[model samples]
Target: MSELATHETSAASFALSAEQEELRSRARALVEREGFAERSLEWEQTGEFPWANVKALAGEGLLATTIPVEHGGNGGSWMEGALVLEEIARACWVTAMASLGEIGVQSQALAAYGSDEVRAKYLPQIASGDLICSVCITEEQAGSDIFSMSTIATDDPDSGEVVVNGGKALISRGDVAGLFVVYVRWSQDPGMRPIGAVLIPRDTPGLTIDEGRETLGGEKLYALSFDTCRIPASYVLARENGFKKMLTAFNGQRCLNAAISVGLAQGAQDAAVAYVKQRVQGGKALAEHQGIQWMIADNEIEIQSARQLVWRAAAAASGGFPNRHDAAIAKVVSNEMALRVTDRVVQLFGGHGWLKEFPAERFLRWARYGPLGGGTPQIQRTAIAREVLK
Candidate 1:
């Protein structure tokens, strides 16, 4: 396919306005200059959350890219947010995981469901990256089935608090998140509506954050447990209709995941191309070899295709409301595309690719996480099927 053929027309049409472009450029320059070029490896080896890098991102206003300017955000569109994530992902995948999760969820949740006072209180600090929030939707038994969640939020008549119970698994940025948008079932009405969401500060009583696990990607995963954790009644995002509210924010999360995968695919392809042009065998650079050339070409084709899917989803999202059908399709396609492209990069490099000395192995590892996290590939397909059939 031609490069022009791959250009995302819809995305190109609603291209980031001049102001958005300026933000992207400025962010790109900062990451290139100040980001951890080599220390990412060390961070990964140590299984650390890369707080210093995240602090740098906050200083640059990336955390606020999607929030409105009135709320102290950079006030960029979802497309611009995607551009920012792409650049950050290119620099360090771990940082992208942390920054994107916070911005994506905060923008969607605060914009749609937050009460005026809620927005006024949290949006500014969150945009400034001074506050980091994580969505607590996936529970121990039910990963994607919101209706099947077992976490409980009981109303305490005496204290006028909602007492929370149960746990969340594999939560990204779990340990370090300063705020949590928790999904829980009302004990008085577990079957009445299935589940509800509550926004709780990290310091809420009876809340425990266990050490994060070692996931396939360098994700800092945490398991959260609530033992009669009491949050003010005002902490409830919306009493009975919390599932709908969580879904609203979830749409943006899926789109952001797609964007990150697209960036990872592109980064792997670029690295492979550079490596091919320099690594010679049989008296000629690997780029001259038919086998290597074919691999590089295929990677390029898939990367661009993935990029279009991502941009299309971003364009739809930027338009005030994203088409969930398109977003699901984009997530599935981009996740699969990244897996293919990164695996090919690993193949092209032969033995060297398997070694940590080269980043291909790391890219391949992180690419696998794309499908597992943010709803599995199986869940995505089911969602797309439901939307298409409906």
Candidate 2:
């Protein structure tokens, strides 16, 4: 963001504009029409990518709304992305998770800092939903502590290219991504200045992608290994002082993560509401039970609170990433709120919630992924404290 842009007043209104509402409606319709809710169970069971839903998103023009308009996208803001993601997640967490790379931090980093050659090569395909990029940031020693990452991108004296060595664990989209935006130590410079990033094509030699453990949300995580992978110098997104740039992108991701969490919690609530209305207990409907009513009330309270926070954070950014402080606060609130709300939904379902055959248990499992993905609630709290102290 430019100095002038930074000074612009952030819109605090939580109400969506006509365009934003239209986007939300489109996403909601797409998910329901395509039966993503039903298909989510199959995805968890088969472990297959939801290719049909991806295409459906593309058809509805929701696939790459976050990328710059010049790059074949609508150049929508994070708020726009949030509206879409939340609706999608409300129906299927798996599809929402799959859409992250294209509409998330990885795309933002690549679009903001990548060389024209790299962005021009990948952004168009991503906007078209024909491609997805796995962001490689987490290493064995680094998850939230990205500065502790040992991945190195050294200039090759002989080949006049960049040679990368080190690995990332628990990366999404590795098995199917066509491109990689990898964060690495770019120089011997002390502190965070040396932490930069590079772009490596998925097919680059010595770049290996291997399957790893499945996540609670039923998405497969993968491990990335770079064994002296050599790439053109043009692939360098930043050589130094890129940490701030990446973080700006991450703030937006945090907002979106919160938005999805809000949606997941609401989805579970939706299921619980329908079930309680129909299921009879003792002599009356479960909805009439005081205990169930109180649980429902609490779920609504948490969901609405998280939604408002997410909207504020997301709306803070006009055409760029949101304020870091706002983003962190929203993420932590939504992450914990979703966990509580989803758990209550499971309990409301009684024995049916515990069975894998039901949706309530699955919603709880999906909510577990909220804090674990963008950053843990602990990490977000630390960030919040640092902001306040500063």
Candidate 3:
């Protein structure tokens, strides 16, 4: 066999343990019981975060599964976490996104870098879904180029605090987050270490949450502004090499993001298949048509391919931080694959796909974010190329 084939065979040999499978089964059951397909529309209309679902996931031990056992988590691997996210996303992208905050990059960052006191206080609450955390990295001018971020956090020696100033836009779950992991430039001097992240509470003085911006996916994206917001110096995550640490943790986010994309595509495909099998056209079901079969086949092929890429990336990062190059490649492929698959699903549904009465259109809308969030496809490709060239 060739090298690529051997790699695929080896990867295929890897299987989930019984415990992981049980976790996946429980998560799937919860999503089915919740009937998120119907409720997702309600949440979109009302612009709510679906706290009930969050609590439900927490009760099932699905939230923050990747957090270490020493820190009140299940001590699960990244693969297990991705599996949970996939099932949740298959139900509703909104709930999936909300769950990501608890189990994705921000939570990992706190677990990996937060002081012992900070971890003891917050990690349990996060794993229990009693608290929500938001990652504040994308600024008005620094969506793709994070180093260009203008937010600054300066330390005060006398007060033993840090004064934070600047704003973040397009932050997911920012409006409802109890904790914010805000990234900022720590120094003005050119040679000094410039980037760092600090924990800021929602009720911190001088911090303001602006009106929510409606994105293509209908999730409420908020802008957070910090005007001389002073937080205790002890809240600092990594003062010197904070940006590097954050970037490393973000590889986990990319893997989970890919899982969400794959799940959304799978959900859209499942909905389309169900619809086509029942809907009669010219005295035959839509599924009986060759054109429809071709579309369905194409979607299935891409979905399976995308899923393998996600699993590979997740596995690579199971023991420690994710392999940056693999994570970037998986993110780019899965994100774009979801867009293509969801678009085909919409087309397969014909007029009903465009109508809000069905879920296909919503899947298409949700898939659009896959490329934009967790670093754009262009950014992922750039990073991948850089790694390859080096």
Q: Which candidate number has the best lDDT?
A: 3
lDDT (C-alpha) at residue 326 in model 3: 84
User: TM-scores of all models?
Assistant: 0.92, 0.94, 0.95
Ranking by lDDT: 3, 2, 1
Give the per-residue lDDT digits (tens) of candidate 1, residues 1-390. 224223433335445566766666776677777755466677788878788888887888877888888888866777877878877776678878878765686555766677787788888888776788888877777876667788888888998988888898878777778889888887545453646688888988888899777876666788999888887787777667666657756777788888889877777776888898999899999999998999888987786677777778778775464567777888899899899999999998889999998978888987887887777889889989897798
Candidate 3 structure quality by residue, lDDT tens digits, 1-390: 234223433455356666766777788788888787779888888888889899988988889688778878988878888889998998799999999978778878888888888899999999999999998889889888887888898988889889999999999897789999998888764432688899999999999999889877778899999999998877889786667777888899999999999899989988999999999999999999999999999998888788888888888885677888888988999999999999998898899999999999999999999989889988998999998899
CA lDDT, candidate 2, residue 76: 91
Give the alpha-carbon lDDT of every model.
0.77, 0.85, 0.86
Q: Going through the candidates in order, what is the number of backbone clashes in each? A: 0, 0, 0
Clash pairs, candidate 1, are none
Weakest ten-residue segment in model 1 by summed lDDT: 1-10
The whole-model C-alpha lDDT of candidate 3 against the native structure comes to 0.86
- Residue 245, model 1: lDDT of 56
> For residues 120-168, what per-residue lDDT tens digits would candidate 2 score against the true structure?
8888899899988777889988888877898999998888999999999
In candidate 3, how many Å is residue 245 off?
Answer: 1.3
